[model samples]
Target: MKTDTIKRVLGYTAPYRLNLIAGFVCALLYVLFTLLGPVLIGRAIDQVFGPGNVNYQGVVFYLALLAVTVLLAAAFQWVLNVCTRNVSAWAANDLRRDAFAVLNRVPLKYIDGHSHGDIISRMVNDAELVAEGLLQGLTQLLPGVATILGTLCVMAVLNPFIALVVVLVTPVSIWFAGFVARRTDGFFRAQSAAQGKLSGYINEMVAGQSIVRSFGYEQRCFEEFDKISDELYETGLKSVFYSSITNPGTRFVNAIVYAAVAVFGALSAISGSISVGQLSCFLTYANQYTKPFNEVTGVLTQMQTALASAERLFAVLDAEPETPDAPDALEPKKCEGAVRVENVAFSYTPKVPLIENFHLDVKPGQRIAIVGPTGCGKTTLINLLMRFYDVREGAIYVDGNEIRTLKRNALRGMYGMVLQETWLKNATVRENIAYGKPDATLEEITAAAKAAYAHGFIKRLPQGYDTMIEPGGGNLSAGQKQLLCIARIMLCQPEMLILDEATSSIDTRTEMLIQQAFEKLIQGRTSFVVAHRLSTIQSADVILVMNAGRIVEQGTHASLLEKGGFYANLYNSQFAVE
Candidate 1:
């Protein structure tokens, strides 16, 4: 799994193979210069401390060679940094772009099932972790390993015994670092999961702040938040603790190697087997030999995290997307507003059906009002119309053609929707209104707003249409935001319309005004209105009173009232107070 994940990650560098190869070559040169410099410096020292008299010229020449090597190594190191940085940048950009594209293609059910905050975390936080890991692994880890191998080879040639000792100490460091990384990997994974849950909770809480305050739930929310925070804290501490051990564990092994090198190299010198200058060189190589261990261990723990992050990123990329358009998918040039639902069966879960054996037929330009209590699948019909979910057992038809054969975008573009909840971006008021018809002229935008009864209030703003609205329609009344949504639909002017309790947020007086606008808006167009207010649908051409996801009664409002069945009772229930 690790190799496959790493290979998949590196595959993104295919477009930058030349740069990556160049970076590796630069790294190789850097290590070569670095390893060679110590030898030349040792030779210069040997000349200075000759048996009878110092060879000053020889010392100077050796020193100069060492200086030039150092300068070249520094320059090569700079090139390595620049090349690796670009490689990582390009890789990260590709990963994030692919992840986002997958998000766009995947079924909405996937998003509904997953925690929103966790999804965001994987996209942003996990992607960043992958980038950091790549930067270190590609630039630092590669160079670090090469440095250790080169130092070991040079050291072995100088003193086989000392080289054997350094080699022996390496296993202890490797084993310890590996042990710590294994122990910490699970901790980091757990910590990431906890963070996702915490982020989800925070997101939900902030969105529902009004409800919490209105219900006096501040203390309860605080206590709940603390519990989640504490869990995250514990997991974080364990992960941090494991990462802390890698540095010290490797250092401990290095100390032992350094001590043994000093003692053995001195013994060799006294036996006249090696000179003081050679011993000095042995000491320098010993430090170089062990330094890579610390560097490698430090980054290994992070590499573990990066791998975990890569695993998450790949999971998103692998998720099943919504069924794609068939090669012969038809794009209808025009649709008459006739719609039919036949033998449709659906459920959020299997075997437990929410809407089953449901059938409906409406002629062109009819106003169909669907009324039911919450959870009775009122909004679900709209979901089906827009193809957010496919019917398990049957089909829907538009213009006498099965909708399943139509391209989803073409089918959905036939309708405009306004829900009870409004969605407004932090853009200019004009931009929000013109979102549906982006190319709409100013006159068209104003005419739509005027039709929706929103022009009066908009003109009172500091800059009218040019005024920027904060996110979620901040600084605007709920009614004002609702008006903006209605104006947006009016601008698009789709052939079929969906109004989902669209007037719920407005005042009764504004409702009366917007209803006038709705009356004008629905003319000569087939519209689906899901309403809780029975009064709003009193004049609907046909009322479908749904109960438990099944249409139990259907007739003109007056006819349903005369029948005194489920529709009459539901209609009566609301007016009982009056």
Candidate 2:
């Protein structure tokens, strides 16, 4: 409802304003020409049949002018359509680009709670609705309304009684359209929401098909899906039923008005109150008036549906992005990989804190291991390091300066991260490795792949380094995907590295091969390794054992075992499980 939001949408048309003006002028001329048709036909009848001096040549000339006007109207309409389509496409593209850019700026928390299908639907379906509302709606609604108004004014001048009948009929038609619109708008909104829900459910089912099959929950899933689909169908039917009534009802009203106009016009002609030509013109105008009424109801129905879509799209566009950096924030000139955490505390929600009074320091080139039970904030620590989420209390520093002081891009550029869940795009092996460093040469990409121990198998692929991956790396083993992720990180050659459960998914034999590569990669660089396998970090310079949002044990692996506390208990538990 904000004026600024509407203005912002209109701003997209600035470049095409001239063409739009021209189109509007052409439409007005076209409507005038349409109105002239009835007058010309009426005049021809008068000239041929009246007792007054007749001009057969003039009647012929009038017919010729009518033909020229019709041709001109058609030509102008074609030009208007071409211009409108080009402008509409440009505006839609710009809106899509700006929407995506805003999405990129929004915080990770916002994305975490939303469904992928719902977001995608807003981007694709809602954008198209806006385009239809702006382009097709304007072109059709404006000219149609103008034609009706112009015809009415001319008819009133020709015969007020006929004009009065049109005026009386219009309000009834408009009132009916309003009633139908009021009923259908809510139904349309509900239907769109239901569609979003259905899309989200379908995406979830497809993504989790493996888990659903393993658990034998196919019947349950099918029942739930059917319930959602039924709701969508019912809501859609309600919307359609309401919209379908409006057009026919308007046409029925127009038919009654048409009958009334004909009877009145004939009486006026019989009484000699109006000429035959004038009666003919009055009837033409009456028909023209009712035509737009019928069409307006249909346009209004489309507008209601489009408004429903626009509401969803605006909801996304209006969502506030994650906290932005201060205008005075500075970009770090250099990074040395020295990191410090001072009494850091974080909580995703208010009721529970994930990290309490956490503190750590790592000198340049030092290697540290963070070992903890599941859900003990190991990955959360890395998230803070990457600034994915800011700490609730306390500060994190890099190179003797507060991290919040540095620009986000500059701060993130210092770290190379390899996460537990490896994701690969459908691209060549070399392209996947070079994702982080797009300008990386083929030699550098191959070197990184070899360092991650992925080069050997990659060469044996159908097209060697150029081999394409299927979606989600479906054609490759889990170990291969992990190795490809590692290769991507290596290509960046970041000064600091965070490896979060990087080896947990690979077999022991493949883990050893990757570990050998990791050992070489970690040399002379500050590193933080989160691991479930205790043997993986026996030689770490410092080991921090976390539990329930607190660091319960801290020291070298040997020292922690010597203490015979929580670390020792955890080690014993893992061995017991084995």
Best by lDDT: 1
Model 2 TM-score is: 0.92
Tens-digit per-residue lDDT, 486-565, candidate 1: 99999999999999999998989989999998998899999999999999999899888887779988999999999999
Q: What is the C-alpha lDDT profile of model 2 across 274-364, one tens digit per residue?
A: 8888788877877887887777676665566666766777677777886787798878766788999999999999897689999898889
> Which parts of model 2 are misplaced by more than 4 Å?
1-11, 50-63
TM-score list, all predictions? 0.95, 0.92
**Alpha carbon lDDT of residue 88, candidate 1?**
85
Worst 10 residues of 1 by lDDT: 42-51
Which lDDT values do the candidates have, in the order given?
Answer: 0.89, 0.84
Q: Which numbered prediction scores highest in TM-score against the true structure?
A: 1
Instruction: Please give the TM-score that candidate 1 achieves against the real structure.
Output: 0.95
Compute the lDDT of residue 508 as modeled in candidate 2.
87
- In order of listing, the candidates' clash counts read 0, 0
